[model samples]
Target chain A: DTAVSQTPKYLVTQMGNDKSIKCEQNLGHDTMYWYKQDSKKFLKIMFSYNNKELIINETVPNRFSPKSPDKAHLNLHINSLELGDSAVYFCASSQEERKAFFGQGTRLTVV
Target chain B: GESVGLHLPTLSVQEGDNSIINCAYSNSASDYFIWYKQESGKGPQFIIDIRSNMDKRQGQRVTVLLNKTVKHLSLQIAATQPGDSAVYFCAEVTGGGNKLTFGTGTQLKVEL
Candidate 1:
C-alpha cells in the first residue's frame, strides 16, 4: 500500500490558470506537510498541518493556500499560477518528531 | 535564517566503492537529523537518521555521522551499486516542531 499519495503526477497549465493538488496519507500521522522542490532540487516547506491545525507557514505567497480537511489529508490550491510556480510539489506525513514519509510528488509546470 | 546546505552538488563513484556526502547546517539548536535518497521522478525516501546525542548511526549499507560542534553531517554508503545512483538530501528538525528543513541535494552517480 502507498503510505503517502498525491494525485495528478503531472500538471501543465497556462500562466493564469488555477490548480489544486491533492494529498492523502494512510500512515495515521498527526503532522502533514506540503513542500516545494525547485529545479535546483531544493526542498522548501510551504505549509504544515498538525491534527488539522495550521502550524507552519513559510514565506510562500498568498496565491498558494493549503487546506487540511483532516489529519490524513492536506491539499494545496494555487490561484493564478505563474511561471515561477513551476516545481515539484511533495506531500509528507510524520508522527511527532520521527522520520517523515513523502509521496511520489506532483510536477507542476506553468506555461 | 537557519538553513542546511551541502558542500558538493554532485559526486561520482565506482561500483563497489564507498561514497560520502557532506552537509552543513547553520542551526546549532537542531537536535534531530535525517538522510533521504531520491531517485528520478520519485519522492525523497528515508535512509538513516541521527540525533545530536549520538555522533554516528548505521543502517544496512548507509551510515550517518553528525558533528554537533561544527554543525556538520555526513552520509557514507558502503559498496555503492548502480541502483544507488540518486540524489541524497540531509534534513534537520529543530525546537521539537518536527518541521524538517532540507539541504541542497547531492547527486550520486555510481558507475560500473
Candidate 2:
C-alpha cells in the first residue's frame, strides 16, 4: 500500500484561480510536511505540522495555507494562485526525527 | 540563514560505474542527514541516511558519507544501473529533527 498519498497528480489552472490539494498518510506518523519543488528542481519546505500543530512555516506567501485536520492528514490550499506558484507540491510524513516518506507529487501549473 | 546546497547540478556515469554526489550545508546544529532519490514525475524517495555520530552508512548499493567537521555530505552508488538515473538530494534535519532542509538536487544519468 502507498504509505503517503496525495490527490490530483497534475493540476493546471489559470492565474488568480484558487485550488486545494489533499494529502493523507497511512504510516501513522506524527509529523507531516508540505514541500515545493521549483522548475530548477530545488526542493524547499513550505510548512510542517507535528501532531496537527504548526511547527515550521517558511517565508511562503500568505496565499498559501496548510491545514492539518489530524496527524494523518495535511492539505494545502492556494488562494489566488500566481504564475510563480507553478511547481510540484509534495506531501511527506515522518515519525519524529526519523526518515520521512514522500508521496507522488502534484504538479501545479498556473497559466 | 541556514541552507544546504549541492556542488554539481548534473552528473553522467556509465553503467557498472560508481557515482558520487556531493552536498554542503551551513547548519552545524543539524545532527541527522538523509539522501533521497527522485525520478521524473515522482517524489523524493529515501535512499540512505547518516547521523552526525557516524561518518558513513551503507545501504544495498548506496552509501552516504557525512563530514560534520566540514559540513559536507556525499552519496555514492555502486555499480550504477540505468534504472538509477534520477535526481539525488541531500537533506539536513534540525529544529529537534522536526524540520528538514533539502539541498539543490543533482541529476544522475547512467548511460549504457
Candidate 3:
C-alpha cells in the first residue's frame, strides 16, 4: 500500500480560480508537510503540521492555507491562485525527526 | 539565510562506475541530513541519511558523507546503473521536527 497519497495528481486551472489538494498518510505519522517544487527542481517548504497543529509556516502568500483535520490527513487550499502558483506540490509525512515519506506529488498548472 | 545548495547541477557517469554528488549548506545548526532521488513524474524518494554526529553512513549501494566543519555533504553511488538516472536532492533538518529544507537537485545520468 502507498504510505502517502495525494489526490488530483494533475490540476489545471485558470488564474483567480481556487483549488484544493488532498493528502493522506497511512504510516501513522504525527507530522506532515507540504513542499513546492518549481521548474528548477528546487523544493521549498510551505507548511508543516504536527498532530493537527500548525508548526511551520513559510513565507507563502495568504492565498495558500493548509488544514489538517487529523493526524492522518493534511490538505492544501489555494485561493485567488496566480500564474506563479504553477508547480508540483508534494505531501510528506514523518515521525518526529525521522526521514519523511513523500507522495507522488500533484502538478498544479495555473494559466 | 540558511539554505542547502548543490555544487554541480548535473553529473554523468558510466554504468558500473561510481558517482558522487556534492551539496553545501549554510546552516551550521543542522543536525540531520538526507538525500532523496526523484525520477520523472514522481516525488523524491529517500535514499540515505546522516546525522551531524556521524561523518559517514552507507545504505545498499549508496553512501552519504557529512562534514560538519565545512557544512558539506556528499552522496556516493557504487556501480551506478541506468535505472539510477534521476535528480538527487540533499535536505537538512534543524531544530528537530519535520521541516526539511531541500537543496537544488542534481541530475544524474548513468550511461549504459
Model 3 segments more than 4 A misplaced: none
In terms of lDDT, the poorest run of 10 residues in model 1 chain B is B92-101
Tens-digit per-residue lDDT, A65-88, candidate 3: 999999999999999999999999
**lDDT tens per residue, model 2, A23-61:** 999999999999999999998999999999998999999
For residues B25-107, could you state the per-residue lDDT of candidate 1 as single tens digits? Answer: 99888878989999999999988888879999999999999988888999999999999999999999885866788999999
- Output the TM-score of candidate 1: 0.97
DockQ of each: 0.74, 0.77, 0.74
As a TM-score, model 3 comes out at 0.97
Q: 1 or 2, which is superior by lDDT?
A: 1
For model 2, residues B1-112, the per-residue Cα lDDT tens digits are 8999999999999999999999999988887899889999889998888888999999999988888889889999999999999999999988888888889999999999
Q: Which DockQ value does candidate 3 get?
A: 0.74
Error of 3 at A25 (Å): 0.8
Residue A79 of model 1: what lDDT?
98
TM-score of chain A of each: 0.98, 0.97, 0.98
The best candidate in terms of DockQ:
2
Give the interface RMSD of candidate 2: 1.2
lDDT digits (tens) for residues A1-111 of candidate 1: 999999999999999998999999999999999999999999999998999999899999999999999899999999999999999999999995548899999999999
Clash count per candidate: 0, 0, 0
Clashing pairs in 1: none
